[model samples]
Target: MLSEVYPFQETAEAARRVQLNDHLGELGVLCLAPSPGLGVTDATLRSRIGEDRITSLMAA
Candidate 1:
C-alpha cells in the first residue's frame, strides 16, 4: 500500500512499480498499487508531529 504522507515520492514509487510489474508479468508475478488513504488515528495525532505539520509536508 502507498502512504498518503509523501504524495510526490509515492507517485514516483508507484510509477516504478508499474514498470516493474510489466517485467514481472513475464515471470507470472503481479504488482498492485493501492492507497492506504490519509488515515491518522488519535495516537498519531498525539505524536511529536501534529496533523498540521503533516498536512504542510504533504502539500510541499
Candidate 2:
C-alpha cells in the first residue's frame, strides 16, 4: 500500500504517503518494493478502483 501512496519521489505524489507510512509502521512492516504491473496506465480502471473498494474486496 505504500507504493500506492508513494509510487515515486516526484512532487505530484500525493500527501497520503505520510499517513500510509505511519500506518505500516504501526503494523511493524515497511514496504520495500512496488508490485509488478501496478502502474496506473489505464485511467478509467484506476478511477473505478479508487472510487470504490468493491473491486479490491472481490476475489477471483
Looking at candidate 2, what is the lDDT of residue 38? 36
- Candidate 2: residue 30 Cα off by (Å): 20
For residues 1-60, could you state the per-residue lDDT of candidate 2 as single tens digits?
A: 322333344324344445555334211111332533334557787787785542321111
Distance from true location, Cα of 23 in model 1, Å: 18
Q: List the candidates' TM-scores in order.
A: 0.24, 0.21
Off by over 4 Å in 2: 1-38, 51-60
Residue-level error in angstroms, candidate 2, position 38: 4.4
Q: Flag clash pairs in model 2.
A: none
Give lDDT for model 2: 0.38
Error of 1 at 11 (Å): 9.0
Residues 1-60, candidate 1, lDDT per residue (tens digit)?
222222343556556666776323221111231223334546755476675554311111
Clashing pairs in 1: none
